[model samples]
Target: MAMYALTEVTKRFTKGRKEVRALDGVDLTVADGDWLAIQGPTGHGKTTLLQLLGALDRPSSGSVLFDGDDLARLSERRLAGVRARSFGFVFQFFNLIPTLTAQENVETALVPLKVSAASRRERAGRALADVGLADRSGHLPAELSGGQQQRVAIARALVTEPAVLLADEPTGNLDEDTRDEIIALLEGLWKDRGLTLITVTHDSTVARRAPRIAWISKGKVSLRKDDRRAARSRAVTTEPKDADSAAVGGAVATAEQSAAPVTTTEPRDAGGTAPGGRVALPEEATAAE
Candidate 1:
């Protein structure tokens, strides 16, 4: 059975008199240990989907099942437990606590689980070391470089040892070189830690690394062609009438409008694992709704 399955799920938001439909009859299945990329243009429900997948939000209608337990049916307390125990989240902005050292920041992930102080510190230390930030563990966010701060954020996410890691635009804040490093680290962790890795991204360079890609458009999802040759063939055959419809909200036009553009990045030789991603803009949530 799939680890996560969404059945015709929909999410609607109402603020004042305005109502927005963020997800429209979306259905998808994610298998265990699957490295799935969820990509689309801005305000197209990508982040909303991630929120639903991570149990951060509930759907308006239909079902969201994690390991066959319906998230929609869970009470808030139960849902919180599921999120704390089963999932780890990274966001677009580092979201590190500025006052805390890297190790202290990582250890906070264990606080909700009520882990003992000694065990929490030990696990946090191991997680930071895994991300190659053991030496920087004593440094505060202000003392670390942007990349190092992001590493600390990643270590915090992994300290809980979650089975599923949800990353929303993980590389959005970094320079080109740092973006590549974070992507390689995430891919390595997905492999080494046997995580069900799901990422939401706009960067073409990062999307191509995933084995499966799901494209969301108009609040619905469709499977993307992952093979380069097949994608090219489809691009060549796309209807001329669809060209204008492809570009929206100041985004660039691509043959596969539903899919994020797939661009190549130079090969990286790094082998270590890390965790990273920051929450998207606050507007993203309301926009999705």
Candidate 2:
């Protein structure tokens, strides 16, 4: 069975008195240990879809099943426990607490799991070391560079030992060199730890690394071929407006093996943050999106 599956899921929201359908009849299945990339333009339900997959929000009309258990049917307390125990999320922004040291920031994730102080500290140190931040564990977010801060955020996500890692624009805020480093770290962790990685990214550099690519547009989700050459070529030749149009239309075919052209320069959201930082509930997600 698929590790996680969305069955005709539809997610709707109210934006300034207008009902916005973020996800409409979206069907997706993520198998265990798969590295899946979800790509699309901003405001095109990518973040909304991630919210559902991570159990941060429930679909409006359909089911989000995790190992065949329906998330919508779980109680709020149970859902919170599931999120803490089963999933790790890394946001585009570092989302680190300003005052906490890198190690302390990572230890925060263990608080809900009721880990002992000694065990939490040990695990946090190991997690930070895994991300190549062992020396920087005592530094605060302000003391570290952007890349270091992001690594700390990643360490925090890892401290929980989650089976799934949900990263939204994991490399969006870094320079080219730093972005490559972070991507390498993520890829290594995904392979070494046998984690199911679900990344929502616009950067073709990051998206192409995943073995499976899925496109989300107009609230629909469909699999597409992972073709880096085609994506890079389109990025060079097409105008932004025309590319956006083609992106929406070209990848929605039924057969699903056809490759869709991916753009390299997608417009970034202001503040360099995604709609939701980490775990967001449905009501909170409506405002964030």
lDDT of 1 by residue, 1-289 (tens): 6999899898876655866666789888888877888876666678878888888778889999999999989998998899889988887777887888999989988998999999999999999999899899899999998888878878888999999998888888899999999999998888778888999888878988776787776576777744333333333444445655444321422433455444423122222211111134222221121
lDDT of 1: 0.77
Q: Each candidate's TM vs. the true structure?
A: 0.79, 0.80
Task: Indicate the worst ten consecutive residues by lDDT in candidate 1.
Answer: 269-278
Per-residue lDDT of 262 in model 1: 43
Write model 2 residue lDDT over 70-143, tens digit each, in one string: 99789989989899999998888778889889999999889889999999999999999999999998999999
Candidate 2 accuracy as lDDT: 0.79
**Candidate 2 weakest ten by summed lDDT:** 269-278
Top-lDDT candidate index: 2
What is residue 158's positional error in candidate 2, in angstroms?
0.7
- Superposed on all Cα atoms, model 2 deviates from the true structure by an RMSD in Å of 10.0
